[model samples]
Structures are given as C-alpha cells and as structure tokens.
Target: MSGDHFHVHGPHDHAVEHAGHGGDDFASQIAVMTAILATVGALFSYQGGATQNDAMLHKNQAAILKTEAANQWAYYQSKGNKQNMAELGAVLTSDEHRNKFEDDVARYKAEKEEIKKKAEALEEKVKAEDELSEASMHVHHRWAQAMTAIQIAISLAAITLLTRKKWLKYGAWGTAAFGAALAALAIAHI
Candidate 1:
C-alpha cells in the first residue's frame, strides 16, 4: 500500500472532531453551564463554612461571658456574707469598737452593689453573644441550602449531557436559579 493510504476514524475520534466543529452545541452549552454552577457552588460552600466558624466563635464567647458572670455573682455573695458578719459584730461589740464594724458594713454593702452590677452586665453580654451565634447559624443553614440546590443542578446538567434532553437542561437551569436565590437570602441574613 502507498504511504497516502486512507485511515479509518474511531467513534470517539469522530465525536471529538464533531464537537470541535460545533456540531454538538448542546454538549458545549451543558459543559459551560456546569462549569459556572460548580464555581458558584464552591463559593456557597465557602460561605457556609465561614458562617459556621463565626457561629462557633460567638458561642464560645457567650460561654466565656457566662463563666465570668458566675464568678462575679460568687464574689457578690461573698461580699454580702461579709456585710452580714460586720452587722453582727457591730451589734455585739462595745461602743468604742462598734463604729469600726459599722464602717466595714457600709463598705461591704457598696462593694456588693458594684459586684452585682458587674455580674448583671456580664449576663447581658452573654445574652447578646448568644443572639449573635444563633443568627450566624441561621445564615450558615441558608448557605448550606443554597449549596445543596446547586449540587442538584450540577447533577442534572450531567444527566442532560448524557441523555441530550432539553427538558433536563431547563430543569437544571431552574434549580440553579433557586440556588442563587437562596444564596441571596443568606447574604441578606434572612
């Protein structure tokens, strides 16, 4: 045979050549759609992770604040006990020593008031941190939902590519739109 003999093309080669010539536009469209969806899904996943981390940090802060508040309450109780002891000492002591006990009682009472206020303020901070943690978790859940929808859309796009079905393409687009909407809600903190 001459060196210029005809060569036979395999099925795969023919399909590849056909795609390069834009003969299978549906496949190219599906390829582009899935690529975009995958990128968006990655962003959604990252946002979900970040939100979760924020929620955990806020929860930890709330717990720390609660412990501090408890300590302040314990200190306040100790001050109250000291005040009671001073009052009793004043009642039982002689006139010359009674004035010192009275002075101690007044100081302890004032210290207890200050400690009580500190404990209450810490409790309020704990409540605020708890609220923030809850809100972050809510946003995280929204991001997760968006990611799930995007994953479904990407799967649908793959199926459409395999089956060459127009309806599946439309369904994939619809699901991707829904995912985008959920991501918007997450951004809005809803």
Candidate 2:
C-alpha cells in the first residue's frame, strides 16, 4: 500500500510539472506569435494606405485629363462655328470674298480634325487613368481584408494568452495564415 501510494503521487507530481511546462511553452509561443502579428499588421496597414493614395492619384489624373478633353471639345465647337460662318460668307459674297471664305473654311476644317484627334486621345488617356484608379482601389481592398484578418488574429492571440488554451492558439495561427495569404495576394497585384 505504501509503495502504491508513492507511485501514484510520483506520477501525479510529474503530470503537474508537465502541465506547468506546457503552459510556459505555450506562453512563450504566444509572445513570439504576438510580435510577428504586430509586425505583419503594421506592414499591411502601410500597404493599405499606399494603395489608397495611389488610387487617389490616379483619380486626380483622370479628372485632369477629362477637364483638358472638355476644353479641347469646346475649342472644336468654336472651330465648327467658324467653319459654318465661313461657308455662309462664301455663298452670300462676291467672287473676291468667296475665295477668301472658301480658304478660311478649309483651314477651319483641317484645324477641327486636329482638335478632334487630340480630344479623342485625351479621352483615351482619361479612360486609362480611370482603369489604373480602379486597379489601385482593388489592391486597397485586398489590403483592407488582410488587415481585418490580422486584427482578428491579434485579438485571438490575446484571448489565447488569457485563457491558456492551446486550441485557441492554433486557431490564432490559422487566422494569421489567412491574413498573410491576403497580403501576398495584394502584393502580387503589382
């Protein structure tokens, strides 16, 4: 009976010590994970801000292009009006005035063609800029998603630390992996 009691107590004490060690190990792991999470979170946040800034820059460029295109169209309209006046003058005037008005009409038509080409090119540029803005916005969205996951993972880590649950730590790691994946996708967009 004495031998059996010692044996039981020995195993019990060993189990307790092992349990204590497990907790300590998990605590250290959580500390390391928390640090990693903080670093990744900061990086994701910076990326999100950069992508947002890029989107805004593209949008501003598109707006400027659109404004310039509008100015060019207005100039084209003025040229059209001048061409019409010249055509009317040609019909109502004498031969000397008619020749001059015809020449003026031709010049105005050529200038209108040039202006049309420029305006169309500007429209294309605006479209390209808008597309860039959309792409940047998409990257920003990915970064936002990553940030969300990272934040959740960080919160879970805190919970794991408080509760001393190894399963919760595993769950936190899973969430952190998801966040990292999202960040990778966002970076790959470049």
Candidate 3:
C-alpha cells in the first residue's frame, strides 16, 4: 500500500466518529446562534443609548426654559418694586413729579404684562418638552427590556453549549423571540 493510501474504518468506529462530529456540529451551531444574539443585543444597546440621550437633551431644554421663565418672573417683580418706589417718590414731591411717576407706573405695568405673557408662553413650551422627554424615556425603557431579554438568550445559548441540552437551545430561541418583540415595540415608539 502507498503511504497516502486511505484506511477504511469498521462500521462501528465510523458510527462513533460520526456521532462525535455531530456533537461538534451542534456546539458550532449554538456558538453561531450566540454570536447572532450578541449582535442583536449590541444594536438594541445603541438604540437604548440614543433614546436615553434624547430624553436627557429634552429635559435639559425644558430646564433651560424654566430657568428663563423664572428670570422673566424675577424681572416682572423688579418692575413692580420700581413702580411702587416711583409712586412713593411722587407722593413726596410735586404735581409734575407725580405725573411723571404715574407715567412710569403705567409703563412698568405694561412691561410686566408683556413679561408675564412671555413667561407663560415659555411655561407652555417647557410642558411640551417635558412630554417629549417622557416619551423618549418610555422608548428607552422598552429598549432596555429588549436588551435584557437578548442578554438572557445569549446566556442560555452558552449554557446549552456547556450542557449539550437541546431544551436550553429552545429556551434561548424563546427568549430571543421575546427580545425581538420588545425591539419591534421600541422601534414603533410604543
């Protein structure tokens, strides 16, 4: 026989070797499934981060608007104080000064009205932004749930490989399906 000649194994040995290779194939399939699950989990993580960032940005904007509204209210208060001081000065002075202070008071009142309107409008804007932030946070929560499911599925897949349990692989599939459903809901913003 040539050095490169093939040796044919007995039927029983062949069957045993085939069974061993079958186990290896099963392990490889589980590894592939775990990798795919990890990829999906990574995508969900990105979406979760993005939604969280959006919520934070909207909250920040609302805070800024509230701060500006507070500043406007403060300005309105200052105007009110100045008007009162002017009125008091007029009482302590002459008729001409009284007329001038009356004009000043009217101007301050008008300006205060304008400021109040602006502050109220800003409050409305803040409310709207807060609603947006809440919505984004809701989406983020969904994505977070999806991430958790995906992670669980991946862990199950690893356990399946370790224990050579077919049932565990099925459980991994079930969890992966659940994760996909959550991810879909998140994408729909529901």
Candidate 4:
C-alpha cells in the first residue's frame, strides 16, 4: 500500500473478484443488476414515446385536412365572378350567362370532390393514429409492470445483503400481486 493514498487497479480487475461470496462479490452483482435494469427501462420508454408521437402526427394531419375542406367550401360560394350560382341556388339571367355559369359550377364541383377525398383520407389516417396510440399505451402499461417487478427484485437483493431477513419472504407476495394485475391488463388489451 502506498503511504500517500495512491490508487491502483486491484489484482487484474476488482470486479471479477467481487462476483461471488467473497471480496466484493456483492458490489459487482449490484453494478451488473443496475446496468441491466437501466438498459431495459430505457428501451421500453423510447418505444412508448415513438408510438405516441406517431399518433399525434396523424391527429394533426386530420385537423389540417378538415380546415382545407372548410376553406374550399367557402371559396366555392363567393359572388361576382360567377361559379357561386349553383351553390347559392341562383339561376342565371340569360342563356349565354347560364352556359358559362354551368361550366364554372362544374369546375368548382370537381375541385370540391378533390377536397372531399382528402378529408376522407384524413379520417382514415386519424383512425390509424388512434390505434397506434392505444398500442403504445399498452406498451407503457407493460413497462410499468416490469418496473414494479424489477424494483421489488432489487429491493429484496438489497435487504438480503443488508439485513439477511429472507428477502423473498418479504418481496414475493407483493411481487405476485402486482404481477398478476399487470398480466390482466396486458391480456385485456389483447
């Protein structure tokens, strides 16, 4: 040992020595368990966020299409330059004007059809969005269930190391109850 508190790597990796019932085995186990839990939680959370975002984007697209439909309907009804006659229920005053008005009304009708199609498409997109969000919610529920189990497992390990009070005896029953509830929720979604 250095007298001035100099640090040194312990015997070709201290972690290897700690993976058992002696030396720092408990410390090594804690470190490995912590890393595993962190990775799983992060993966689950990312998936949940991505699915939720997809749902929101679809809702926004639907709203935009609805607005466009309203705008087209309004534009097709304005006066002066004609085309509004059919929509306004006003017959033309002469044959020439009537023929031109018929053409104009036909064009606007076609444009309105295009807008109607877009709105219908938007409705389908929104429905798909809803389904995606619901699926994400299901994933989130599963993550929560897994988290509860992980927490109990970690706690039991800690208590066993600290107090030697038969960790499973304290942790198992609560773990089962929560696990069953989570399983029920997951099955309900199915």
Which is the leading candidate under lDDT?
Answer: 1
Per model, state how many residue pairs clash: 0, 0, 0, 2
The superposed Cα distance between candidate 1 and the true structure at residue 88, in angstroms, equals 1.6
Off by over 4 Å in 4: 1-92, 167-190
lDDT of 3 at 21: 58
Instruction: Identify the runs in model 2 with alpha carbons over 4 angstroms from their true place.
Output: 1-23
Q: What TM-scores do the predictions have?
A: 0.92, 0.86, 0.84, 0.56
**Backbone steric clashes in candidate 4, count:** 2
lDDT of each: 0.97, 0.94, 0.94, 0.58
lDDT of 1 by residue, 1-190 (tens): 5789988899998898787564767888999999999999999999999999999999999999999999999999999999999999999999999999999999998999899999999999999999999999999999999999999999999999999999999999999999999999999999
Itemize residue pairs with steric clashes in candidate 1: none
Candidate 2 lDDT over 106-171, as tens digits, reads: 999999999999999999999999999999999999999999999999999999999998899999
- For residues 1-190, what per-residue lDDT tens digits would candidate 3 score against the true structure? 6889988899998888788554578888998999899999999999999999999999999999999999999998999999899878878988867888888888988999999999999999999999999999999999999999999999999999999999999999999999999999999999
- Candidate 3 local accuracy as lDDT? 0.94
Ranking by TM-score: 1, 2, 3, 4
**Which runs in model 1 stand beyond 4 Å of their true positions?**
1-9, 16-19
